[model samples]
Target: MAFVPEEDTHRSSNSTYRAVGRADQEPLLGKQLTRLPPSLQRPEDRCHATYAIFFSLGIGGLLPWNFFVTAKEYWAFKLRNCSGPASRGYPEDSDILNYFESYLAIASTAPSVLCLVANFLLVNRVPVRVRVLASLIVTLSIFVVMSVLVKVDTSSWTRGFFTVTIICMAIVSGSATIFNSSIFGLTGSFPMRNAQALISGGAMGGTVSAVASLVDLAASSDVRDSALAFFLTAVVFLGLCMGLYLLLPRLEYARFYMRPVGPVRVFSGEEELPQDSPHSPLVASRPLGSHTPPLRPILKKTAGLGFCIAYLFFITALIFPAISTNIESLHKDSGSPWTTKFFVPLTTFLLFNFADLCGRQVTAWIQVPGPNSKVLPGLSLLRTGLVPLFILCNYQPRVHLTTVVFRSDVYPVLFTCLLGLSNGYLSTLALIYGPKIVPRELAEATGVVMSFYIYIGLMLGSACSALLEHLI
Candidate 1:
């Protein structure tokens, strides 16, 4: 889906804006303006800022835990074809991967669920702010749980203690949203295009790290220990996440999504919180018929858009799991050096990052007709993306099932790199653009919802691909 232009009715103090693609620009712009009420800079908020920084650090630290695929692979691969006793799957071969992912999908969605409920309550009887705060609390609760539950280390026994990994991912994904919105409230909220650049840059940090882990895994004499190092990297990031979150000024959670309440200064944890960023307007309309408690729960902005982004990521992630497991197997099968093994993932990540950067640049510079209107012009780029996405979804990814790319069909290797660039660019654009679809307040919910959708897309397309592999 593409970003809708800001309606003509939207106005802002930033005199730089001209008559945009004429529909109303959801009131996101003027938000990033440095001005704010005196209360925002209060000495009290400074103390709150400390915790927020630590929180961001903790979230970032989770990146290395990579157990999501590393350990999940242990079960998913074995279930279809157990190569040996070592491949029997997690928690004693129960196909437990589903349990963790499913649980993650549901638990991770709590903020989204609460957002939907919050919106509904605002429409009917309850106070929307209460719902928002409650949801935020619940979200952060789960995040902390993860740090404790998921023991991050390099122990062989730790390979599948994914129970902790499961809990940790859910918390990080949700809590990140909880605090991020507050940050958006702080930094004169960024626009859709700019936010994308920042987020891609932020996530790219991890992509680079993932590739490094791949190299380490390949370089090590023992793959098991390498996997441990990988998990530990995540822990370091988690600590970093905590630190970033600590820097934010804690504004009252009341209506942080829509109209500015003041400096809650936070990053976008939600998929999209309406801001100066071409953020979408949440529907003000109430439920139609009798009130049976809407089946969708509380999510609005982040759930739908976040799901879309996450689904795409899932497709991308599918390639990841296959890359590591299959490549090692291929090296053994064909007798090649492990150096290329690291290079494969590293190269793919570079391509994706490159694409993402290009997309952001295009959005930033290509101002439309009436001078430089960054918002509307950037929104248009999302539609033209079909070509690249098609190429990504259709072309087979490079596989190192035994040795190296040199021995594998040359076709797959070349296309794999191309796909990397395409997916990377599209993903960056998708994340930036996705948030503009709903109300600003719901950005956090959107992030996890997107994560859920990402998993679905990955499951649907990848399951089929894997099935084909099974058959062949």
Candidate 2:
């Protein structure tokens, strides 16, 4: 007999019933399980490896999106002014900058909306690996193309070329949704911490990108070089991510996750397994279980979780890059001209990215331990009020009815930290709680739906950004 561990034997002996799973899975489960590869055979090593995969996926998925967002000051300013130092002097054309800002939000919004459609239509039909690989290829190609375009003619770029560039970025950004949604579904078979780890990795990607921008911008007097450094770094990261993903299926983690059936639930002959597991009322313990419930009930169970996820991103996209960038510089008297130049673009961006990363990590410490929390959904709703607060930070002279709170710049920075923390912690909590509350069978579907909702929020926020720009 193959050696089952003592804990496995104990659990099997005490178990009430064998996990009731799909009829097709019986033959596969009955066969002796294959031993894990030497690379990830140990439990601790497997766990570490899994965490790395989740984290890498998060970083890889979000890196391209952040590449444009973190570099907003450079591109938007250049697109409008046609050629100039991005570091100092007020934009000669504020209207053009504002127009690009609204358009930028639209670029982000449109792709996410398209992805929402793709999620329902193509996500399931397409193979997971195929979808991920295709998206990565598109993303890498976009980065390389954008880098070359900027390198060749950023100084003499016309409005027509800039519009084309935005469209290209939108295509790449929208594809991230498909990649991330697929990844979320893959993680459904794992523990909640893996989900949190994935999101934290995304925050990490944004933070690192923002830091790189600051460093690159500081190194070169010319803005074009900074822009080149930014895109080249992204290309390198994407290449590494592609390599990691290619190796994913070979890992023991992917082998385990890709199976049609999930972990075995050994039971003693005497004990009767309930038709439905208490852990997941909608279905049995394993994902491909016989006791999978109807879609309606599964949707109902996960509805709040989905709403929280959607609402969190909605608030985020609404004011973030579009409105946040418009905040006037506060420290004109700080002595250094560079401080005024980089305050909002570099300093504020870093604060939010770093704080957001910390917020996501905090969940690992203060986790509710499990998915059972009534307070979680309500928390998502309360975050909506923060939108107005962020808008209030815009401090322009003679702007009618705009509330300028603490014109000293410190106020927005603090609010930004709070915003980033709440964004990271709340969204991570919502995503983690989502799959846990449902049966294994429905967990992946639920995750896909939540991913859909996230982009929907982004879409709505993008629309709202256009409206908010008018108000400002």
Candidate 3:
């Protein structure tokens, strides 16, 4: 070989090593946004399409439940004679309607509680696609069955079968808990808006159901026709939810979440590993090449946030469907066969639903301060007082306040709106805030835990609403 200085040889070797390093880093550079601190990431990094998907998924999950609950007038009317002869119209069978309402309330929440509890075992352990696809299939199947049952002659299905239908519907609600957690967890890698979309979708579900109920009530001559309309609506929306979820994983943005392990960074189309919090799950010290962390540690970190999340839902469950249905109208004289203005499921319920949607959407503009903000938690606890306030709106013995305080139709509607606004705003904040306070890598697990807490609250609240039957 030609003579060459050792210095030159060493320089050449250094250049070769540098080239090798760059070549090796090329792939990881594209994959490395997780390494960057969140503040440094581009503001426009999030995929806006996911917001719509999350919202649709939310509506899909809750619409079926909302359909049954919102169409309370139709069911109460058709099934009034189940135990005996037809009990007349309007407020004639109020007692029986109240009893059935409580039963359905319990049935609605029981399965959600079960599913949320089981999520610890199912959420992280199951593959994302499997969990999502299975939940959608099961939910869609339930809607199909509901449509078929309602389409058949109401006489063929006895009260016992109606109970069975409630049980089946409850199971679908439970499946929704899983579906929600999965969707919420996936969005942890994106903007908080995506998570809020899921919640807002729930509000939208109620709104849509409310609107449909109004239409059915206006157009249908018979209660059976109303049932058919509601069930048909459910099937169509649920099918759409399924289709949207199937497309979720295929999105380039979703690739961040489809990883075998938790994502190290938020998705961004940039090169080089971004710097993140040193204590972040992505940057935290780990043994060897392991990216998966123990669930226990993640759970421990999120336990407090989970409790707050649970408490918020618990408050909502206690007041909503169960108590909201029991509030007495000031004047039962709308003359419409469907309902009075003050009726629990009428304008009052729809007001709450619409106001709730507005409250959740408000988060897109104004986020609750943070996990440490007492405002959200305080609002949740304050809702407990609404239970008694709403009870007072109805004609009840022992409480003279019932006649004095919420006597006007406007009072209950305003309170219901407030109740809904708080519910939507607080719960949405809890869900959105819970994962953020923890490591990004453990966000998926935190989401499951948060959901578990929410269902716990719902179950307890529904159960507690039963006491109101005795109290009022």
Model 2 is weakest, by summed lDDT over 10 consecutive residues, at 10-19
TM-score of 3: 0.80
Question: What does candidate 2's lDDT look like per residue over 1-472, in tens digits?
Answer: 1222223321110011122244432210121112233564323325477678779889988888887877865676576545455423445345556556667667866787678566645544677788888888888888888888776654444555667777887888777877888788767656555777788999999888888887877777777778888888888988888787777777765565555644323222243324233322223343333332244554665677777777888888876877776676665667665546677755467888888899888876555322334566777778888777776764453256556766666767777887888888888867766655444544566677777778878878888887777766
Better of 1 and 3 by TM-score: 3
**Cα misplacement distance, residue 297 of candidate 2 (Å):** 4.6
Ten-residue segment with the worst summed lDDT in candidate 1? 8-17
Query: Candidate 2 regions off by >4 Å?
Result: 1-44, 84-94, 154-157, 262-298, 333-338, 369-372
Off by over 4 Å in 1: 1-189, 250-259, 262-320, 323-334, 338-344, 347-410, 434-472
**Candidate 2 Cα RMSD after full superposition onto the native fold (Å):** 8.5
Tens-digit lDDT track for model 1 on 62-108? 23323343333333432322334543544444434333334334444
For model 2 the local lDDT of residue 66 reads 82
For each candidate in the order shown, give its overall lDDT on alpha carbons.
Answer: 0.39, 0.66, 0.65
Displacement of the residue 401 alpha carbon in candidate 1, Å:
14
- On a 0 to 100 scale, what is the lDDT of residue 127 in model 1? 36
Model 1 alpha-carbon miss at residue 407, Å: 7.1
Candidate number of the best lDDT: 2
Instruction: Name model 3 segments beyond 4 Å from true.
Output: 1-34, 37-47, 82-96, 260-295, 333-343, 395-404
